[model samples]
Target: MRIIGRALAAMVLLVTAAVAGAVEEDGYELWMRYRPLDKAAQSALQPRATALVYSGTASPTAQAAISELQRGFGGMLGKVPAADTQLRNGAIVLATPASMPELAKGLEALGSEGYQLRSTVVQGKKLTVIAANSDKGLLYGAFALLRAVGTGAKLDALNTSSAPKLQLRLLNHWDNLDRTVERGYAGESIWDWWRLPDIRDRRYTDYARANASLGINGTVLNNVNSKPEILTAPWIAKAAAVADVLRPYGIKVYLSARWSTPLELKETKTADPLAPEVAEWWTRKADEIYRAIPDFGGFLVKANSEGQPGPQDYHRSHADGANMLARAVAPYKGIVMWRAFVYAHEKPVDRARQAYDEFKPLDGTFLPNVMVQVKNGAIDFQPREPFHPLFGAMPKTPLMMEFQITKEYLGFSTHMAYLGAMYEETLREDTQQKPGGFTVAQVLEDKDHGQRLTGMAGVANIGSERNWSGSHFDQANWYAYGRLAWDPQASARELAREWAAQTFTPDPRVTGPVVDMMMLSREAVVNYMTPIGLHHLMGTGHHHGPAPWVDSLGRPDWNPVYYHKADRQGVGFDRTATGSDALAQYAAPIARQYADPRTTPAKYLLWFHHLPWDYAMPSGRTLWAEMIAHYDQGVGEAKDLRARWEKLKPFIDARRHEDTANLLDVQVKEAQWWRDACIAYFQSVSGKALPQGVKAPARTLDYYKSLHFPYAPGRG
Candidate 1:
């Protein structure tokens, strides 16, 4: 009778807790969750971390470091360690040479943003010291310390030194004035433009913390397709309000300014770069912005590209447009990020060749502060594309890497495609520009190129969703981008492992399966969606699902048929000597290899050279057979990924675990859909039969084409 009463009491307690909403972890905590550690491990490490000491002036950035450390320790260890000015045994000390003269000599090696963290006995006191040249570096060091502990690094034996490889690491938000995000899948834009100047959201603080944790320093707050009002007086005040919050975290706010802003705002008759009134208007605008936000990072302009106005509208070159804005901001130490994505689809030539054709000849003409932002590939962010020819081609101008993090071409936020592997592939590709002298990274770092500044930008996937990014896994891509931007040479696999450990659990069993799933994710998306060099085969408008059969769009570039060129005689676009000769745009070695279908790497075979359906591949299978096999392989990978996530249920929290499990289920279903939809359309165009062992597509081409998502998220 007593035992039954006890059981009944426990059941009541459980029900009451559920009714009151016992903590359900939505992923708003990102990698900085700092959740409580396992009791046994916490007990073991507690003695080694008995004290915390900071001997520096309490600058806002330095205080941020102290506060973050306290929060991390409190959550992870179940108690905040003692804080003091004097170092003690087992103390974790943060100091700059300016504060601690004893640490001054060693800190000279670490640059302004660099820091050295080491464990040693100082004055007979065994301690861990994070010494840097400045307080900003101390804040970065603090985050690094928390990251190490969260990822299971031993604090007692810590020894590490680090600095950023790139000077500018930025997130380009495609958020519009109306809070509608272009290509954003998570939710509405996080920026509440209507209430910014008066009401600062706490989410803004969390956003700054997240970026600082990863060493990201800049953010462009609006879409490249920007409205002129963003540059007006009202918006400048709002920007200042947000900037004040982010300043202490070491992040600067940038804006995407319209090239025709002066005209659009009715401040000038024309926006021609050479026009004196237009030049005066931009100069005044820069002055106004700088006066409000003293450290405002300048404009990101998308010009005569996509019908946006530019110098070209008045018969001037891209250099003229970029330089005019550069001069205006030069007085205030701001930059102009001029996009190199301009292309004319009206031209019959290959779309891949157009950017280089327009910008190559005027390479040396851009001003020092003008960074020509080039997309990772010559074509838009496809599933797979060769590195852009412009990377090492234009040595005289500074070029910034623009990688899209929104997954616009890779099935948005629903699909589980990790982009770390994709970034590593492009960053490592050898440009072979001058007799083995340069890689893509090397070109940007080169002093001879007159590159006073170098940077990388990612199109942000962040939104108002509780998880930050739409899916739990999509957060990994955002984390990966910031880490890569800080150090271009870092390994994606290592980044994935660290992120998996910090984000989910440090347990080998949980992290092992997660990392394995992430490593192969992007390849699986490529296999099912485009396979071996096919590009941009999604729906005409929303870019959701497949519609490779669509032929009648306004412009040829907007149609999938124009890209793939699948026909009864052959399949694949011919960019070789016989067709558009786009291969010639690359250096001699690359051009020579891609000139022939047989010589090109099988992964990029169809991209550079078109081939017949019956052409034999190195895999000892016919081209049609190989493509079908790839599609089948991708579907299998998706199923495997879903199964792998199920194994993590024992380790992950119930809420996050279930969310990821459901998303993975969607990924598997979509993978099959992508495979079937693409295969059906190609078969119709090529008039080919499936290989003997390969299964037929699940539906007809017309049925797949009939699947429309006119109301898909992120179609603003």
Candidate 2:
């Protein structure tokens, strides 16, 4: 019995050791995934990162840089370099002019936030210097240097400097006070509202670390469809606690202020922008907030669009409302981001035209601290949208681009629809803000906006899921948004490549195929869901799946049919002269290009004009036939994505590979559903037979219409 017991103890010890030493990776690290490299890569890197010589006592941001470099080195090379006080062989120095003046020459040109990394031979040893104007720059430089090393950039010839193209890069969370996230497909909100200033989760620091790693500087907490109570004293303390965690990472916290706060709080009878009491109440509120969080980034307002109260209620313009709040925060150097996604409650002459019409006239009337935040497209975040007409039209107003990083209309988290392509497409558009001049990206970098701030905001798609974003690939969108926000003109394909290299492996063999698939992912979604300019064809309230036939909503714009008017004569909404004439909202050149089908880009042909089923396409096929080809191609792409990822199984771990594979299986099925249901509906309306060699939908139109999701994910 004694011999058996001793043997059992030995077996238990062996099991415990095995469990402790096992190599397992859940995707919580995201693109910062710095698992140890293989023998060769680690062997090449370990000697170069032998010592980190960051002079003087480190500031919080510098300390952050030091910690990150250590983490990266330890993880990737299995070597955490010693923090040496003096320079030595292959020593990497994180420095500013005040800290190490010898290494800071030519760094003055790098600006406050910009950084430079240079490799020089000092005496006989290699010295890599990361020099900057400030501690923030040193931190950014640290990330750049590590990223290059991780991606296998040659260390010998390294010389690089980069500054943010936009002044403010922010992430907007749509988390409600109740902890439910609107349009969030991930799990519950990460912000635990129940836990106050008392219990600050370690996840808060992790969140800040992630954002700082990507050059993101601000986060707007709470939903745009906000609750009034968030502005109360208790909530202010809770927000301050979060701000405390993020401040070290150089991130300022902003809040979505419900415009009707005073009214709901009974601090005032009416929340009119022009009313003295209302203005005073807001001023006091801003002061209180600033007192708690001295570096508080200001308000994000969503008003008068979707039943949200606004200054328009008191017959004042949007500028009036924005200016009123802008005044309140401007004293503390804070700015207000007023959303331009609006229309009257009644059906508009064209819902797409409403925002442009309203804001265009009041462009110069806004306060210096107020910026109008415009969506990337005229409509909501469709699978594809012509760049929003407002991008170039409102040059007098400080216009900030708002991209949805969350896949709200693009199959939520289930489908792999990379958004890097979508972001690049809109940013690169020739906005024609000046004749023979600015692209949409250039317009954002305009220095003439005076005291008006230039910035970009992304609707954050994050949650309490262990991986942060629900799916693994959704992490790419978050990473892409941050990278592009730093430099809007940065190539999405290159970012995809870099992301794949760092997140998976620096191995080009793994990265090359991943880049190809991601580059095509967004277009694949557009093909299946809204090919040829068809938009807003998803289910009504939840927007879960196909519902092109839906037309019973109270407001015309709420119904999908209003966007795509399919009939016996033609299909697609006509924005040309004969219909809404919404094209007139664009520049004359753009209007002319889209005036006739002959000049319009084939991708957007159906969006701006309605054409008969037999109309000849540029491909020498009938419009009906071409549409079928796109839908079929989309289905093929979905299947191809699955097969391609399957081959990558040998490279990726079982956990992430399996998660993606299962989702791809669902995506392929749903892509077919989108293709079939849309084809069925279009056929019913157009009275056109399936083109020769085209497969007819497997089910009747009634079968699809009967498929309903009374309860779907998101929209909490």
What lDDT does the true structure give each of the candidates?
A: 0.88, 0.89
Question: After superposition, which runs of candidate 1 have C-alpha atoms over 4 Å from their true positions?
Answer: 1-12, 15-24, 447-451
Query: For residues 166-253, what per-residue lDDT tens digits would candidate 2 score against the true structure?
Result: 8889999999888889999889998998996898888888889889878999999899998898999999999999999899888999
RMSD of each: 2.0, 2.2
Q: Give candidate 2's whole-model lDDT.
A: 0.89
Query: Residues 9-111, candidate 1, lDDT per residue (tens digit)?
Result: 9999999889545346788888998878899879866865677788746888888888888888888998998888987888888877778767545766567
Q: Which ten residues in a row have the lowest lDDT in candidate 1?
A: 442-451
